[model samples]
Target: MTSLLLVEDDAVIRTSVSLALERYGYHVTTADDGLSGLEAAQTGGHDLLLLDVMLPSLDGISLCRKIRETSQVPILMMSARGDGLDVVAGLEGGADDYVVKPVDLPVLVARIRSLLRRTTIAQPQPETGQVGATLAFGELSVDTGSLEVRRAGQRLELSPTELRLLLEFAAHPGIVLERATLLRTVWDYGWDGDSRVVDLCVQRLRKKVGAERIETVRGFGYRLNTT
Candidate 1:
């Protein structure tokens, strides 16, 4: 059973979502406010967190940052608004994914499962037929066998999604990786996947990998300029 911590302020939403999640075979633990959620998160046994963006004492974004300071536990943020800023803020605050309110249980469950899968996957090993055993682009070095990345002699703290995106770029340096291809490869998204996720993740990756490493292809998608 997958242990989950749900931090939601709304009474109806908390109860309803908890029951729905439990029916889907998850072991759900609920917290009604940010303080308690933070405390529960610190206690640290849950496999994932479903955090509401609005709460008392501490908002979801702040709580997410605080938790990130100590844990890399995958987080899925929930908000009533679909505002671009809210989504980007949640992702920037260290959330792995976000879903707007009035969330359809099925879709929410699918997202949860995907995030869990990403977290649980073992670090990849380099295979003979793989893209590359090791790759170096400028000062950046990536060891595919160990799933390690080093730049300028310093290691970067990247989420699994971020690491995968970087690896995809390294595999095909200078190739314009279409958003649709990235969605399928990095996010495992089907035709219905949102391209915005790729854009947001690319923005985040640029912060770590340096903005010059990835080039926006204007009307197309993105290309990794190894030069």
Candidate 2:
């Protein structure tokens, strides 16, 4: 049986979710606060985590960051409503997906299955050991295998999405990669998220890797300057 941690302060919601998940063959562990949930995740037993955005202690975003710092255990965040800010916060905090409340039990189960499927396929990434075989572009260096980027030997912290964006731009340096194409290629959104998501990630990446390293063409997409 797959083990899952369900962290929600609402007793009714918690019990219902637990029973539903149990019926679906998941052994669910319940927690009423963010701290307990974080402890459960840190213990290294659960296959997945179901986190509530609000709780009595600590917010879901902070807990998510703590969880991601060590474990890549798939996290699915639940919110009171489909608030975009909450969803984005969850995502930025390393949650794999978000679901709003008043969700169908069957749909929730399906989402859990989908998230687990992705988690099952995910391989552990190698540690950032060596920044070798570096692809040098002007003052920027991207080390693919180590997944590190540096400018003038100063390390830059790139989120997973930002890193993927940097790689795509690096691969096709000096090319006018369109917003649609980049959304499809970098995010695998296949134009679903379109420019907004891609553009946000790109903007963050630019801040990390340095603005000069990435050039924004008016009414067009981005490119590595290759200066």
Top lDDT: which candidate number?
1
User: Whole-model lDDT for model 1 versus the true structure?
Assistant: 0.86
Ten contiguous residues with the weakest lDDT in model 1: 119-128
Predicted candidate 2 versus true structure: per-residue lDDT over 1-227, tens digit per residue: 89999999899999998998898899999999999988888888888899999887888889988987777677888977647787777776777656789657876786687667555333336666654467989889987666668988998755445666687888888998888887666544422442555565566567767788888888988888998
Off by over 4 Å in 2: 1-6, 10-30, 44-50, 65-76, 80-82, 91-133, 155-157, 194-196, 217-220
Off by over 4 Å in 1: 122-132
Tens-digit lDDT track of model 1 for 1-227: 89999999999999999999999999999999999999999998999999998899899999999998888788999977566677778888888788888888987998898888777552665466756366888878888777778888789777777888888888889999999999887776655676778888899888887888899998789988886
lDDT of 2 at 177: 88
- What count of clashes does model 2 give? 0
Clash totals for all candidate models? 0, 0
| Structural similarity to truth (TM-score) of each candidate | 0.89, 0.62
C-alpha displacement of 196 in model 2, angstroms? 4.5
